[model samples]
Target: MKQLNILLTAVALLLFTQEQAHSQIKLSDIFKKVTDRQSSSATSAGAPTTSEIGLGIKEALQLGVSAGADRLSVKDGFLGNLAVKILMPPEAQKVEKTLRGIGLNSLCDNVITSLNRAAEDAAKEAKPIFISAIKQMTLTDATNILLGKTDAATEYFKRVTSAQLTEKFSPIVTTSLNKVNATKYYSDLTTQYNRLPLVKPVNTNLTAYVTQKAIDGLFIEVAKEELKIRGNINARSSTLLQKVFGYADKKKS
Candidate 1:
């Protein structure tokens, strides 16, 4: 019995030593294991860092333009929509106000409506040129634009394509103005407005003004679409957009 008790005591002592060793594992050692695991995971994941912000910005800008352009190309997208109606600039505004102030409101209304209609007609011709611009947009260009301000992409577009678009749009607007009888309406309106006593003689090139206004309106619409995608969760139409923009959304949150 004494021998058996001694053997039992030895076995119990061995188990207690093992249990104590297991429980006595150093907190610092445990913490080191966790740190090593985290470091290995971080190295393996290889997520894009701060340097790639330019790239992300570019992707977002391109996506915005794509979405905006797509929306603008549709029927009633630019033409029938009053919200984005193409109108005159500061120069033409003076002419319009004078005309309306002189009780020639009907003539003034007609001329303004005709100008916008010409723009609407001319805008249809812009698809090919705008598409070419989009196609020519390089990864670097997109990255730079993405890194730019809210209107940076727009400014880039204006800098790069404005001359070409203006050149192309002028003839189209002129042709559309003629097609829609804009020249005659504006001529009559101008003659009536200029004859008003105490008013300066007003001479406006309807074609040039309409063309520029139309292009500006198109850009405005494009920007709206871009803003929607950047802000509204539901506006993200594709998986690529969702995946890429998901990061942007997280940052905002």
Candidate 2:
């Protein structure tokens, strides 16, 4: 009888211990889940939403485009800026060289100046095109742009708006070229070059060349503006910009 009573007590003690351990494990799991949920909620609360990301990216792009267009549209914008100044086409380098060789320096200078003038004129019309592209940005695009490389937004603009910009800029450039007498001067330069003894005739498309250069210059400016906004806190002008880009800054870090 004593041995049986001892065995029963031992069994009861073992079961009680097991039950306590099981309860502890269950409580531990519940606490961990609650903590996890709280942490996740905190993270989400600190992060920007999908809509805010899209709006922030759009705002940044618009500001960039406007600044870029405004800088290039002013007088001496392209002419004074060596970075974007339109010059003689590669195929016409020989022509310019030949023209300048024979006391035609004045005419060569005129051609270079007029080419930049046309580009400057065409740059004035880029803001609207860029704004339209910004308006069309999707949530996927916004997220990618925010996390992508320094020039990702600029690349996006180039990819989406290049064709439309070309279409819009061609006529404006052509008109500007004529207004500035670039066409006449180029024709005169090429004519003189072609007439030179033993020289191959060259007929480069001035309008097409100038249009592409102008587009490239605008993109360059836009890229700079984008970098400024991403890397500099002060560049975020509005409350929305600050909130959106602040979230981006945190994510990047």
- Which candidate ranks first by lDDT, i.e. highest? 2
Give per-residue CA lDDT, model 1, range 1-253, as digits (tens).
9999999999999999998887677766888899999999957745344445444544555566665555554554555677676555566678777767868787766766677777766666666666667667776666555444556667777777788879988998888788777888888877776786888777877777887887887788667766676678787666555644565555446
Give model 2's TM-score versus the native structure: 0.80
Cα TM-score per model: 0.67, 0.80
lDDT comparing candidate 2 with the true structure: 0.93
lDDT of 2 by residue, 64-179 (tens): 99999999998888988888888899998988888888999998999999999999999989999999999999999999999889999999999999999999999999999999
The C-alpha RMSD in Å for every predicted model, in order, reads: 6.8, 10.9
TM-score of 1: 0.67
What value does the lDDT take at residue 54 in candidate 2? 96
Worst 10 residues of 1 by lDDT: 45-54
Looking at model 1, the pairs that clash are: 57-146, 58-142
Off by over 4 Å in 2: 1-45
